[model samples]
Target chain A: MLNISNIVLEIFNILMKRIVLMGVIILMVVATVYLWLSNSGFSEGEGPYLGIIALILVFAVFLLIRRIKSWKVGEPQEDELSKKVMVRTAALSYYVSLYLWVFLLYMQDRVTFDKDRLIGIGILGMAIIFALSWVFHHFRGVPND
Target chain B: MTNRIKEFRVKLGLTQEELAKKVNVRRETIVFLEKNKYNPSLRLAFDLAQILNVSVEDLFSFEDEK
Candidate 1:
């Protein structure tokens, strides 16, 4: 009654669950890129709407990630090592963002750049670094149960 | 901080994954423990000892740390 196929499928399922949040993030990034590429620039009708779309996507991604983590393994997702990794991620992201901001400010004096876009990109950079680092560390450390 | 976790686990014929599942930790945690690279929390020490059917002192020897 070993049911080797069932065991293989079960392992596959856990691997899928582990990458679920990362997959969603990738899809969202692709959608945003597609949107940006199709338009010469945010048109009058779409400019304001882009902000709303970004906001909605951000919230949706946040909620979905939390849901997936909490439900994974039916155990508390934030263990001691996870907390430590998160704290480390946050600290590293802060330093990275700080350096990036300084570089952006320096480049601003040399060329005309949209301040809003630069700020948005800076924030996005920090968020992606923190999120990806956290996920990488957690998954690398996760027990293969 | 050296311990006999691996020895006891092997004696019981448990894989790292099985022991990790029993302790509700990741397999990496067990690997680190076996290599004496990670120290266990007091609760984890108790859990491991209970799982191995041995007292904490029997599982981990700390005189070397002194």
Candidate 2:
């Protein structure tokens, strides 16, 4: 039986997922702006905490958004190719992020940036590396075994 | 492994987007399949074969790697 209502509902659900993702991104941007611009009574040494907090918040929100999207769709959105690409991206980013952390640790003593700032940079770098790895795998194709 | 997905799809007058829709996958997946770059799961292979009106063996072939 052709369920027209279900089809319409599925379309609406897909739109809702897009809206949720966009909302999360907008909120992340606004929160980042607020963290940087608002002069609370925090000391200069405490400023890095704001960036780290914003980064964590955004990451958590994105994960939550993915969960919500899959829940709404009644299945994981990732198909076979996407799942493979995701696995490759995760493996690549895991090694790269570890290298980034080690590099940051090595430079902490020599660099003027404090440990807190270095931590923030490490978190941001990890996220960027993961995103870039995904893009690369998605376009370049995960090599077949 | 290599697949005749593009050949069969073309013979059937179906575009990549149409085939992807029939198989419930993204167009990019069909593109990869045609290029023999990404390996599809058994379920996906069965679905694609069914949609193309061909047997699984007729759709995909294993190449000897020496």
Candidate 3:
């Protein structure tokens, strides 16, 4: 008998498993690509390829963090420690971005501020937030499962 | 603040996990409540009290200073 609740539960489990599996696959692929690019002797300023690579990495890390945040297994729905770590990291990033903006105001006295520079700073802020969140989460006694 | 969560949970023979499931929260949240490490929001306290068959006032008491 195909119970509707049972079928829904099974589908949910399968979807969760697939999401986790996909995260692992993406990490592996990113690692392989990074390694291959580093080994390929691609010189700098090759049509902004390095910039493209960094963008890809930033996106990949963002997805990975989202996956980790949503992950729940073996009795606890959300990890409190991980949540704390994320909050702390985000706070730090916010402070850093604020300081950077203040510094930019000071720089305005010496040079003109442009839209491109502002956009670059925004991207840098987000990248720092993503990277620091992962680093804090990884180091804070909670093993990445 | 003090609460009757532990007493009610015990009376019902429900582990923190079971009560948490009924309340839609993590077990640690229940532990935090029992230990008074965390205070529940008004909505959460109301939900918990409803599930435990008690009024919010019955579930939680304010500290005298507060």
Candidate with the greatest lDDT versus the true structure:
2
Question: How is the predicted docking of candidate 2 categorized under the CAPRI scheme?
Answer: acceptable
What C-alpha lDDT, on a 0 to 100 scale, does residue A92 get in candidate 1?
72
- In model 1, the Cα lDDT at residue A61 comes to 70
Model 1 chain A worst lDDT window (10 residues): A136-145
Please, what are the lDDT tens digits per residue for candidate 1 over residues A28-144? 776876777587665685564466446545744764676465546444444455555567667777877788788888988998878887777677666666666666654454221
| lDDT against true structure, model 3 | 0.68
Output the worst ten-in-a-row residue range by lDDT, candidate 1 chain B: B57-66
Sorting all predicted structures by TM-score, with the top scorer first, yields 2, 1, 3
Docking class of 3: incorrect
DockQ of each: 0.15, 0.46, 0.11
Q: Mind sharing the TM-score for model 1? A: 0.57
- Quote the positional error of residue A107 for candidate 3 in Å: 12
- Least accurate 10 contiguous residues by lDDT in model 3 chain B: B23-32
Interface RMSD of every predicted model, in angstroms: 7.9, 3.5, 9.3
Off by over 4 Å in 2: A1-11, A40-77
Candidates 2 and 3: which is better by lDDT? 2
True interface contacts retained by model 3: 0.08
Query: With candidate 2 superimposed using the best TM-score fit, by how many Å does residue A26's alpha carbon deviate from the native?
Result: 4.1
